[model samples]
Target: MTRRPTPLKQWRLRAASLALTLPLSLAVAAANKPAQGDYFERIATFPVYHNLAEGEARATETVAEITTASSDGSTLYYTDSPRQRLGLVDIRNPEAPRPAGFLQLEGEPTSVATHRHFILVAVNTSLDYARPDGVLAVFDIRDPRAPKRVASLATGGQPDSVAVSPTGRFAAVAIENERNEDLNKGLLPQFPAGHLNVVDLAGQPADWRIRKVALSGLAKIAGEDPEPEYVSINALDIAAVTLQENNHVVLVDLRRARVLHHFSAGSVDLHGVDIEENDRIQPTASLLGKRREPDAITWVGPLLATANEGDYKDADKVEGGSRGFTLFDPRGKIWHESGASLEQALIRAGHYPESRSENKGIEPEGIASARFGKRQLLFVGSERGNLVAVYDASKPWSPRLEQLLPTGVGPEGLLPIPSRNLLVVSSETDAADDGYRSTLSIYRLGAKRAEYPQIQSDPKQLLPWGALSGMVADRDARKRLYAVPDSYYKASRIFRIDAGRTPALIDGEIELHKGGSSVDYDLEGIAQAGNGDFWLASEGDGKKRPNLLLRTNASGEVLREYALPEAVAAQATSNGFEGVAVTGEGALERVYVAFQREWRNDPAGQVKIGVFNPNNEQWRFFHYPLDQAPDGAWVGLSEITAVDDERFLVLERDNRSGPDAEVKRLYGISIAGVEPQADGTTLPLLRKRLVRDLLPDLAASNGWVPDKVEGVALDTRGELFVVTDNDGVEDASGETRFLRLGRLRP
Candidate 1:
């Protein structure tokens, strides 16, 4: 039985959603070397599973929770709690980092901080949730090949976030005796509240003086449960600790082990926010009393900046940290709040997680700031968004967003190695379905355009668009094109694209409606109508929703609707009406809908392309031959567009991603000398001619090849365009690649 989430579990899922928004496109333009300019690009990626020792099953789970680099930025160290070990990486050659070694410990390593020649790890040894116990394990790493642990000290509770001072004189750990949300509805003020541990690092590792600083009676909410989620120490030895569940930030002097300042992280009224997880992205809700339950904290001079993940509910409602980051001074004076703009930017970049829109909207979890050359950069890791945002934070007060960097699932640890002009990030998500293990991504800032987010909606337009299945060029304007979503989104939308933009911009969108009320359907194919209306194909899955053909005006008002005949409807097996195209004019207009897979009566390797005429109120079918599958891959048609009066452009692709993708191409088929089969007869197979090979385009960016090559459109100048579906960031790395293939000779 599928267990329904309890109230507490529901809240946990809510927080999980905050951290779970998931899924990519790498496009054609990246094939050529980009011109030299200031931008960030992912240089390399090191999967944590590569560090598995001899005889270890490749299936063993591992994760990089917290990461830190050596002082010279040549070596990397990360905590892997699942393996109860510390993994090392040798990045002497920044572009190609190899596994150095691993240090298996007795307990789970939660966080790590590197200072000078030593690495400090906070280890959790708790037998249970209530009776929490931990230890501080110090490793001397003067030699990259041989890392030795010289000291260990008892921590009062379970430790989470750890930080080291610039002078290497002290280190601080946030003893987050984190509460299991499954217990007591995950309420606050439970016994044995957590505290902060300040250790003097000047002495021997084992003999370092450790001080447990109590942080109770400071925050307004759950004063006793002072669970410090994250801590950051600065040059002055002042540490900023975030009491995440309590929605507060506390500053402690590491030298004195005393609280110097404390204040509520405060609340902000959010506008234009998507509040419902209804498989849609609608920025119509407002959060008035949302708490900024900041989870990650970092220091910028004397001020502190936090990534407000908003992990738990503090009030009667289920609203916490309404998404984004905030910069504040030591006294808790708010310097600047990103408000809804942070998430809105993610939406514009085509990286927004629609599945997690209701839960903190791409939860910003980890943050790191460093100065390289003349500029200071701030990196914010969005756990659910699966991407890190880079910004020029030189001003300290106002940061300029530079680009969005893609990472593996659940980006939890961020380490900026400014000395090498490099940044490292760790993702903890381990998927069992595909053997997708944890990953570590390395990005370097150099003279180049940002090598990510091939397509994005206009920031000024703020169009919520993804999973684009079918597309059609504008009748009068080539640069203007319209596309529709698949079943991924609940909102039935028609999006307009401007192919002239760098990444091809989603300039605008129109929501569909029926009888003056808003309505939603699984819109797959869209074609422009003669009288400024649109012809839409809503797909069916055989089991429930039937195939529907709709005629709507530009404003999305339903003008006409048509259902398929029972014979055709009965033949569908979830692969119905994927694309639509039209030929002829006005009364004699012939609408063509492409069925994604082979139908009941069709050949094993052939699929039907149905043609409907409004004049005769009748339908006909034509068979399109499919390419042979390779190994575990299946080839099928995803889009069909009218190239001219007698020819059509069809998009054919395989069901494989990454290196396994063998075919992602376009084919041209003509009906000039052929006759479509009558309503109930054997379908006539149409011959196909190679139009273009899309594999080079998908491989140009050097990223993983995406599986869904869904939409294609042709401009008035005969320029070709293509787009891939991101699956609404659900269990996939949300990257949308929109490519302008340029003018194709027809």
Candidate 2:
């Protein structure tokens, strides 16, 4: 018998394999894609609430957890556990998927699988954790609108995952008698143990028999109690089951109804990863000998891929999550372990969830494999990151990351339809108050490159960056841009972006330092002066942090700080000092700051624009008229850019996102003849002209419209640029859209 490789040996082997087989180009394209080859582009997004039954309140929560498609791959069926219904969708028109309807189920549906004209649904009907009971309900899906339940077989325990064999003769369900997390901190070995339920799908549906396969004594950690989380069947009718909390993986021979082999899912040594929740994404920590408690598993030929989600935490607060994924051979030998690559890839794309660093970074929880033409593909879904990673699995031993697709809040279901060259992902998080609803996103595989990640950091010099509050083009370099982050981060740094790339790349960063130590400021805006220095604008709340401006040298060292007049600063709200700009040279130089919303003393629909003369230390103010805002939404200026000494452009937008978004535009304002006033004086309302409306550009991506169009600038070549804030990926889908618009007309 071959001895299983130790964690150190496994790590060394993987590193050697990667060093030999992985190319530099393949490594850099892991988070982004090249400008060639077929890729999946999101074509449509279906709101799960549209499938609500007639007379149902729209405010009620509905989610699409686990999804499955019909044999022909034209219709999709998803489980809505919150509503106890099975939702259906017609995808004949892949670009425009429609809600077919929904069917009320007797119990909460955990998973769904399809074989031929039949659909197998795992329903959890257990009254409590101690007494586990479930049913494998078989339905004839020939008529999807009205799927008739042909038979219901007792599953002996609460089921979590269901799968059908390729032979169409057998179906398997993982009856995971899940434990209540509140009881005893969710220690294992609770009363009734869970097992596997194999359904013999021969003859009539009513004649199907459920065979119980005891999974006890198989795991080395928790032998008495086993909670099977996910199941996948290979071409040989072999079932692969993941006992998540037990930190083990088992293979069952469905033909003989017995265990074929078992192995500990094992742990990995994670290096160069962020392991703390410090509101910063610095990947320089190590998690050695961490258990890989896999959550979802799928077979890639003779190989197995597991999403190590690490859902179990010991009494000492040590979690089993290894913060990555793993690939294993049939003999339990580790083929490859993605230690920190996935999380690093997410960080480059600005999708790394810093809030989840303490538990599981991004939380890889869903996996799907399929063959599109001759290219074998593997997709891994990140639960907290809200994106799916696609990999080329042609060489099973060395899979290359090909693309990253953005999804909703919690992407729980990943289904690939190779017949139509499409992939579907379902998100389960539904909180309308938070502006994120459960959705099913559809994608087609014909694009030359992925449309997402319009902006990303260079993978070679990876650095995590998000919350792009303001941007400004370099005074001399037309292809160079600088952006600053808001209070979302602990330390403020100036990010240097190379705008020449197809998807602009962040290649360098300059940390702002003051008094020999790094400084943490709500740096909202940045403007490069003719002397190569920078004028930084810091937004402030009415109380603690007063609105201020700072002058920084080219190396990002704070030289001086200028606070607003006490009388004017006292009447400001939290939305103060959003954008900043500079004009003229030497004694004639002046700095301008755009306040986001109206101050307490200002009139409604009008905001103040302040100008400061550095030579004289005198301040003057002018008012910028605002556009009519949509109901339940407010509009404000996000950025200010100098078109010339007397002309300027300001980015104005509303707070609503998605379909409700409006008033995102760029307006031109001039100080040609307008006179500015001092504090406690009536300011002149400057006349404004519409420069451009960014709504079409925001909607051109065919995805949800982001509300915060925070940054806009005109480069030295007269070209325009725009960027959106991701709120540092906190309670928001961390997707930063960096767009390069053409030259601006005078």
Candidate 3:
């Protein structure tokens, strides 16, 4: 999403593609189906769910994370990294999870979470380490029914995780602090240690209340608060026993308006702790054993773990570390010494006699603790082994390994839904390798065995595991699993997975115009139009250009392609647009598109959005100039729903400018004037405008630079949902992601 004076190569590609024109029949045929046996061939493989052979997994240089959610506990949200947006599926009936919708994001999203009322997302700023920052977005889900964003927040550094409080009063964010002095010497000031921030949400019925807090301050007063009183809680303390420095976790206490703690388990220069266990009584114990007899031990916890980035030995490495998890008590107490201390202790003690030499060692990057069916379990997602290691956390002081489940690529996130005895594991492909595509490994745990001392320690089988198509975006569902594919240049595809059955590819491709990247999947963002028709917004292109307004039938047939206005097109600079919502009554229906302009050298980089009147088939474009607003770059615009007639909520990018600029703003836009057409369709005429001079509010704010904004949707309550793309591009500052704004209040 980073804007770089419109590189010549991209322009050449665009010009080349535009110049080439095939015969109408040939073009139509090509679009309908890809050539058979071609590398990019389109196959009609009945969506199958099963484990892939180790050799069959495709590798990607960089595998971003995927997020999803579902209403009726049957749908799932997903995104394709290469495609750059989110997709949905109906899994209520496992064997036939239906394709729902595709929602686009400004950049690439690293993490995704969903609640009954909203979908929350954390996107990585551009892939550039020099420009580190991310956006926090919220979607309204009042309609488990149709989901959309109601509010959003901007955070410095890559956002790792987001959690909404039970009361939905606030959102706690964990921002990854990976900025180093060396990398930021000439960039803007380095971010203070990556810390947790809090967004003060307005009440449930209101829009998002955006705010931020520092972790240093939260750590200063950790003892004075209750477990759930904080705005957001950092679980890294527990994770520290296993995470590396480049992979720390931030805990925010929203209720207390402070950060509770920051845990840096692995770092470039240090190696963390490693724990092991033994159960057999060896005759050799008498030769070296002290008064403490280690013979009676039947089980062990965290048999071995370490925290550091895995590339510690590589040359030109900016960071040093391996990955592993730490241990903490139930009350959140660190059970082991620092990683340095533990590593030193393990080295001095030498290998234990009971330790097996053939056991594969792992550097875990993801850690989770949960209670399932009366068994307290600790799960470690490993980057080295690409497996999920399960442990008994019944006694946090001494966790014991129970089982290990093989996953594809580098396993990162683990979501366990005990209500259905399901485990959803997300994999991040190695950035340095190819043929390693990302995947979501779903495992069904068998009946618990009672023979072991700890419920989690008993041998349990993992059954019916499935590998989903494409990398995941955000997943949501109550019983079924929903997913979206990962693509860079195409619209995302949606799929549904029914429990105990094969998955179904509901729709074909959800077109998001030319540069769709990051994607957010929220509930209300998807809806049903008349006679099985569905309407979705393509949030404009990232280069500040018009986007596509997609209309399709229930089976995923494109009924019409509404060309957006140039004003709207100009607002979506390089970070192609996202965020689409539908509102109004039948004949007078309206669709709003949020414009996320790029920051160009021009003094007046602007954002122009479009509103379509489906009934009359006409379009009216709105212009938001950068020159008039405080911080004009409105990156991610999630939703645009009507509060009532004549009044509308326009969610925008609201935050502080990056190193080159100042304040950021997010607010609402008012709509008036309705026109009807003879065919009952609202179509916009094609009129071109200077992308840089359209929005006065945008030009004055951020000094006119192209921005990448993405994601948009409308909730069932008539609220809007918006998100931005953080392209995760290398070395580019700012998340390829713009901002995400959800409109709930009129």
* Cα TM-score of candidate 2: 0.94
TM-scores for the candidates: 0.88, 0.94, 0.39
The 10-residue segment with the lowest total lDDT in model 2: 19-28
Candidate 3 lDDT tens digits, 281-358: 121211110010000001112212222223222133222223234443222334532233222221211111112111
Show where candidate 2 strays beyond 4 Å.
1-36
Cα lDDT tens digits, model 2, 353-390, are: 88888888889999989887667789999999988999
Worst lDDT run of 10 residues, candidate 3, spans 289-298
**Ranking of candidates on lDDT, top first:** 2, 1, 3
True-structure lDDT of candidate 2: 0.87
- Evaluated at residue 148, the lDDT of candidate 1 is 89
User: Candidate 1: misplaced stretches above 4 Å?
Assistant: 1-36, 50-61, 89-102, 140-151, 432-437, 529-532, 586-588, 630-633, 678-682, 689-691, 702-704
Query: Which residue runs does candidate 3 get wrong by more than 4 Å?
Result: 1-64, 79-82, 93-101, 125-133, 142-146, 156-158, 180-189, 204-206, 216-252, 260-323, 330-333, 336-361, 430-436, 447-746
Candidate 1, which ten residues in sequence have the lowest lDDT sum? Answer: 21-30
* Residue 45 in candidate 1, Cα distance off native in Å: 3.9
Clashing pairs in 1: 22-729, 23-732, 23-733, 23-734, 24-735, 25-735, 37-447
